[model samples]
Target: MNVFYEEAGTFKVGAILADNNTSLQIEAVHGKRSKIKASAVLFRFDTPPLAEFMGHVQKIAEELDPNFLWECCAQEIEFASDALATDYFGHTPNPVEAAATLLLLQNAPMYFYKKGHGRYKAAPPDALKAALAGQERKRLLAEQQARYVEQLNQFILPEEFKPSLSQLLYKPDKNSTEWKALEIVCTEKKLSAVKLMEKCGAIPSSHDYHFNQFIWEFFPEGTGFGELESQPAVENIVDLPHADAAAFSIDDASTTEIDDAFSVTPLSFGSFRIGIHIAAPALGIPPESALDQLAATRLSTVYLPGNKITMLPDGVITRFTLAEQAICPVVSLYLEVSDDYTVTGIESRIELIKITANLRHNELEQHFNDDALSKGHLQHALSKELTFLWNFACKLEKLRGKSNDTNNDKIDYSFEINDEHVSIIERRRGSPIDKVVSELMIYVNTEWGRQLTDAGITGIFRSQMNGKVKMSTSPAPHQGLGVSQYAWSSSPMRRYVDLINQRQLIALLRNEPPPYSRDSNNLLIAMRDFETAYGIYGEFQRSMERYWCLRWLLQEKIQTINAQVIKENLVKLDHIPLVTRVASLPEIAPGAYVKLRLSEIDLLERTFHAEFLQKQDS
Candidate 1:
């Protein structure tokens, strides 16, 4: 006898090999033997051959309409399949008809829900309607996904992907239909999402692509001060004592956030009092204020070629920056030095000072440089002051045991971008302009850090012992700088850590309770967050600088370039701060100059391939 049964949610017909009351041993139509429970059996039949049984059952089931079967049944009521078949066929049904009806009911789960062995119930109208709608929606989405895949495969971006292009490129949502289709196409084509999008003309500018990728990760809200209320008036603060001498600031031509300046006043006995005046934004931007919070979020000014995101707003910078012909508030550190360049006295004060001039390095370096110093005269109006400061700076450098070392004379490169053209200028690291400004700033930071420590006030200090530099709350020696302790309190207008340390120093000078205590959680949290953000920002800046270096190469259209080998296969290109590997480079020693043939520059990927041409004489 042939028995129809349900096993593993599937229907099958088998010939019974042995009959048991609770279980049956049977041989399937395919001659495969199996064991099934007797309760799973729907019905039994004979006379029809087993091979033709399933084909006949499928044909009969196909001929029956599931909607018609559901309409024929009482709504929300269960009944045996054999009884339903009998009622539908208008007579006592045979085994074939009953099995076909059961198969149809089993297949259409949305139309009929199975309750028990050979028992079923028609779905409620509301549930059936919702289920049908969902199925139709799925069908439409599948069709749409197919279309998206077809277009992407043909290097065409779909209109649906236009709105989410940045997100799909930078930070993709894996479950999104667009991203799913992209994944399918990417796997099939073996191309990255960026490359595929670029092939489809989705990315217009490679520069913006790289720039926006960083912006998406770091500044998702865009680099803008959003809806900041009117800042507190800085000009109306408490009256500050004015300094007795005119001060001048030296910075790059493009600088607007002038943070530090200097004044050299001569006294009797050929002794001079040199003032290191730092812009005091901490006076107006009190701790936990709105402006302070804004500064804290940014941590530091993000600088790159042709652009920058300032830590403070333009209005705040303008109010506090030591611009020419303006009296700006400052935290001054004055040093009394003798004619022998020995520092005899040191004092700190909070006062206002008139900025007499804002000297640009490009213009100032032309006059106040080594050639002019050797001649004992400079052509600029601040010639005497520059001469004195240069001498004093040399003395200070010698005192710190940081004399000029020719072996470590590295070149500093500055980038200027105008109308899609790039000019990379190289400056010597230990030039007179650099040394004078750097030594004085270092001395003031060291001095203020020492004072903060002596007064027992909590401040952030930077130390380098064992050649590894780090930020900490306590004071330690910075062996690299040859200073006992160093704190970054000079550029409060540009760095959050400097601003934080400035607040502590200002409070220490005023003999008031410091803003941050030794165990302040805010101080610790700010220190950690600033260090992380500062490093990430520096990396982004270097990446952008590298991007522009590649741009400059293309702009000039030069094929052969010069590079100095740093080690085997790695070299630093001349005239730009770019280091890359040349796979074709012959085994060569470090510090040897070689000519390289550049090819296959990819801006989107920020990479280039260089082939070694010939070694040049050093």
Candidate 2:
């Protein structure tokens, strides 16, 4: 006898091999034997052949209309498949018709719900309508996905991707259709999403692509400071005492936020009173003010090759920056130095001072340099003052036990970008300009930190111990600077930590309670946030600098460059500040110069392939 039964939601025809009433052992048409429950059997009959049963049943099932069968079944409750087939066929149903009916009902889950073995109930009208609509929508979405994949594969960005280009590039939603299609194409082409998007003309400039990726994460609202409330007029602030000195600032040619400046006034007994004047933004911007909050959010100015995002607004910076020919309010640290450049007295005051000049490094270095100072003659108007300051700086360096530091021999590279072209200029560290500025800044910061400690005030400090640098509220020794304690009180216009420390110093000078107490959570939070943001900004700056270095290489277009091995396959290029690995480099010692053949420079990936040609004589 042939039996049609359902197993694991599939229908099959088999001949009964053994019967135990409750369970039957049967041999399928393919000669595979299985034990199935009798309840799973839809019907039993003597057929033309067991192997031919399913073929005939499937043909009949295909000929029947599922909708008609659903309508023919009872809607209110479950009914047996044989009963429905008998009602539809208008006669006593045979085994083939009953099995075909059962198969049709089982397949059309949207039209009928399976209740028991060979029994089903018709779905409600509303549910069937919703399911059909959802199925149609999925069908349409599949077609749309196919179209998107086709267009992307052909290097054509679909119109749907225009509005979401940044989102797709920076923070992709995996469930999104556009990203789904993009992921498919990227996998097939063996390229990153950014590279694939670039191929589809979605990314125009590789520089902007990398830059925007950072902006998306850090400055999600964009780099613009939108419609800040006007700051209080500088004249409306407290009237400070006018300083009797003509101060001048020394900075890069492109610096607009001039934070620190210097003045040298001859005192009695052949001594000079040197002033380190820092821009007093803390006087105008109070703690928890809008401008202060903005600065706190940014933490520090983000610097790149050709641009920067200032922590303060332009109006605030302009008012606070010690521009030449302007009388600006400042926090001055005066040092009474003897004829021998020994600091005999130290004093801190808040006063107004006229900025005599803003000396730029590009022009000032030509007149006030080590060579010119060594000869006892400088070509600038402040020649005498710069020479005296340089002598004092050397004294300070010697006192710190860093007089003959070898680190002075290191080279620092500065990037100059003009009309998208880059020029990398190398400047030696520990030059006259760098030494004088660095030494004075360090002295003032150390002095201010000491004062804050003596006055029982809490300030943010930068501490380096055991080769690790960190920010803390309490003062600690900076081993590298050879200072007892180091606080950042200069460059308030560029750094938020400097601004916070400046506020504390101002309070201490005025004999008022400090804004941040010993256990101030705001101070601790600011310290933590500033450290994280500063590190992120520094990394971004370095990445951009590296990008420009690569651009400079491509702009100059010279192959076969020289690089010095740092360790193993790692090498640092000669002209630019780029370090890469040469896979083909032979075993060599560090500091050995070698010629490299460069190829396959990829800006998107910020990488290149280098082949070691020959080792050069050291």
Candidate 3:
């Protein structure tokens, strides 16, 4: 028996050209019989294209009734030659279907073939039936989703593209607060659910983001925000301190708030006198104001893929951080430093420094081998400055490091996927400008810190003790910079504790009693608070970002990715528990050129694909 399988609607046959003997669609009804029987693999092809013919049926004996085979037959078909089509054209009552027809003839007595004389029954495995059903469901869902997206792309708002009505069926009403409110109003309107939701006059309360501008529409004339809108702009303004700080940039997330300004002058004995600018956010915009309160809530800017949510409004934070750049009045910390970066003495002074622009902005880093900031200009400058501040900060960092030495490394590195090429890049090399700026800030911050302590001034102080942060390191003496009483007192734009610290320093310089007593608001407590705030700030941003990034990593196309064992008993993707060496860098493993396998990657579910590269010892 011969069963020829070819792509549906094709003029030429593929299986025959491959020298396959088992199946052939030919002009002859049968091939020459072989004396000996043997096994061979032939005539197997992928499923016939749904839109194309299955192939022509030539010289069939008879057709089956109930027409299951014919109805299920492919959309198209072809015969070996045009002449053969004429001989068998519509001869039988109904032509035999593709597969079953061939099978029926094969099982029949070839010398006396008659399709009506025999019946075919197929009992496929139970698993195959279930698998086919699942595949069908998936196809249907995908088709629906694609259709929804297509319809939505049309008639979107001229200015903004919005989801289609069909797409909204899949969107949950709970997504926004405005939506929640709309649900209530819609239900009360007594209209059909679809009609109520589609009404134009009132947008959903779920759109809290546009609430202030839109709230009026929801209320009757007397109940709306008419009075608030009519109030004079001057009346809405509150009593606040003047902020003349340089505008905040989105690029600097460093410790320096750059609230105030300073200029260093060399003094005797290798000591240099320093100046400090205290940022006064509470002055121009009181902490009680709407903008300030909101900024406090966000605590820091958030960076998420495709979008970002800033802690403070761009108009305020970007323009009102405060510094010498705008000639804002500030209490400055003056101090003398030795060659080793040691502060011999500190003094408090008042200053009107010129601020150039907002310096406290988002942090920018170059990817390995990618430089946009003048080739390590920033990194180099920062390094030199830190090196110069060695006298002051290096000592503090070592003490902290000594306390933190027992901690293990937190970061692991890699670059590869399933033998696909991805190269490893090196850390940044900073520029001279970076070093100078970094050193200047360190010097200024340390000087003021000592003057406040010496002047009996006290306020909230922050300490990241070496042994305190155990997951990464225990809070002990911080080794990042060396100092016995190393603490943060630099930036006030974002940090509440830093603000309080600056206030205390301001008091000392003004010869006024410090507003806070150390006994009441010590640095240790401030550290805890700072840590809490940092965690909260990071939670909304980095923590979620990591989850998404990991998800992307899992769905990457490379079959194998360079991986390193960073920990033991890491969880495998699919929530399937597995144990393996942590962060085992695959490329650096015992051998080279070994094949690897990607077990799984589920981005929607946020999981890592556990790969098995080298085989176990045989």
Report the number of the highest-lDDT candidate.
1
Candidate 2 structure quality by residue, lDDT tens digits, 336-408: 9999999999999999999999999999999988888778779999988898899999999999988989889
For 1-618, candidate 1 gives per-residue lDDT tens digits of 989898989888999999998889999877899899999888888947888888888889999999898889999789999989998999887877888898999999989999998889999999998988998988998999999999999999999999989999999999888888988999999998889999988999998998899889988888877765346534534878999989999999989999999999998899999999999999988789878888889999999999898998888888999999999999999999999989999999999999999999999998988888888778999988888899999998998898965623999999999988999999989899999999999999999999999999999999999999999999999999999999999999999999999999989988989999978988999999999999999999999999999999999997899999999899999999999999999999999999999999889999999999999998
Off by over 4 Å in 3: 1-263, 266-271, 274-278, 287-292, 300-308, 322-331, 339-342, 355-458, 464-466, 469-487, 513-533, 551-556, 570-599, 615-618
Clashing pairs in 1: none
Ranking by lDDT: 1, 2, 3
Error of 2 at 149 (Å): 1.2
lDDT of 3 by residue, 33-114 (tens): 3221112221333344322223433333245322333333222342221112223244322222343344433433211122
* Model 2 ranges off by over 4 Å: 60-76, 82-88, 91-93, 121-126, 229-236
List the global CA lDDT of all models.
0.92, 0.89, 0.39
TM-score of each: 0.91, 0.94, 0.43
* TM-score of structure candidate 3: 0.43
What range of 10 consecutive residues in model 1 has the weakest lDDT sum? 228-237
